[model samples]
Target: MQLSETGRGVLVSGASRGLGRAVARAFAANGDRVAVHYGTRADEARATLASLEGSGHVLVGGDLADPGDAARVVDEAAEALGEAGGGSGIDVLVNNAAVNLPHPLAETPYEEWAALWQRHVSVNLLATANLSHLVARRLIDRGAAGRIVNIGSRGAFRGEPDHPAYGATKAAVHALGQSLAVSLGPHGIGVASVAPGFFATERVASRLTGAEGDAIRAQSPFGRVADPAEIAAAVLWLASPAAEWASGTILDLNGASYLRS
Candidate 1:
């Protein structure tokens, strides 16, 4: 519950680039000792670590598709953050790593469709669940308060026709966060999720310049998509003690692009 200017230890997964990198920077700027976790981009992860405002940031690399690797990543992050913060365990866990692949039912073959579904479910849902469980267990054991912020997608509430698995997994993520919130609340752990619409990140830069750019922007009344920093700011706030009462909430960061009744 004590996250001061000398902030808490935080772990940001898949932080080599895009939204994950932005989230990492936000926490570091708040004086948190961050553990930047990446799947394959070592150089980019190192760059993220270097871009952190405060010192004591570390880099962790692992493929979350494997349950073992997911557990190891959390363990390594906890160890590194604890060492950096005078043996204090990680205070925040950001589940931002995911596999978002487009597989239109009309265009994709059955074999490829199955593979894509497996990949998406494994990384987006299973991996996140594993990480959350590990982190929650650690916090409970230590009798410490912590936070878990899941990075979901607007497609969960709206729709992703081309990437049905992505949408489904994100929906599952939101539900998982709520379930965890209820279960972990008594342990002083907060769990929440943010469902963001299209953001202008490196991954979708080309899409923003393509023929569908205008349509995408028009989805929001602002006439533009979200910026990475905006999503990062929401995440930073959600992971803070100030948002403890907001647990079990699946916050919408879609810029009014999609509203559900």
Candidate 2:
């Protein structure tokens, strides 16, 4: 289905780089006014804004790990986009900020292991929940139809031995999206998630170039990990009005890397 030419206000968290940046660009390309949200990376976020195709794009900065900051980020985005587009609130939200620090049980110490889990859960799960709630409320108050797309991980199903916390939080995110889909459907809001495996983002580019590259590629029959833009495309589709019935769905973008029965 083709997207509407009329511009909508979109807020993409973690838009400074990687999949977030790509998602922001994708929405902008479709004529939406986007709020590019970053965490302590103003320069990179500006670069993302500059790369977008349209005007009315704004830059918002906040650390998602802090609930207060997450709320503020949403408010700022809504206000900025509202001023630019003559709308009162955001039309779509993409929750893509997360922490993926590896803390292999065997090599890591107990203190660090515990810290890793806490940080990952705080940022990946709690923050997403907070932002979703804020955006949902705004959408409801404005009586507007909207979309929420959570960036999950294939590790949620396949497992992440080196980063169990990351996997657990992603799985929780998928579940959260499902719950929101049900609760918000009556209000004309669609909620869904995407679980991607081994994307070729800057954060993992070093590993993709090292000795483990081939093995990672072999995980998928395609013999290549996903490009950020591919993931961004899926996000765009899910956020479209055509995907309204797809609410509560968890779309897997793993390229057949880890099939779940």
On a 0 to 100 scale, what is the lDDT of residue 186 in model 1?
Answer: 93
lDDT of 2 by residue, 51-72 (tens): 9997989999998999899989
Candidate 1, residues 52-95, lDDT tens digits: the string is: 99887889999998999988988888888774355766889999
Tell me the lDDT of model 1 at 216: 94
**Alpha carbon lDDT at 136, candidate 2:** 90
* Weakest lDDT window of 10 consecutive positions for candidate 1: 1-10
Query: Which portions of model 2 show Cα errors greater than 4 Å?
Result: 1-5, 83-88
Model 1 global lDDT (CA atoms, 0 to 1): 0.91
Which residue pairs collide in model 2, if any?
none
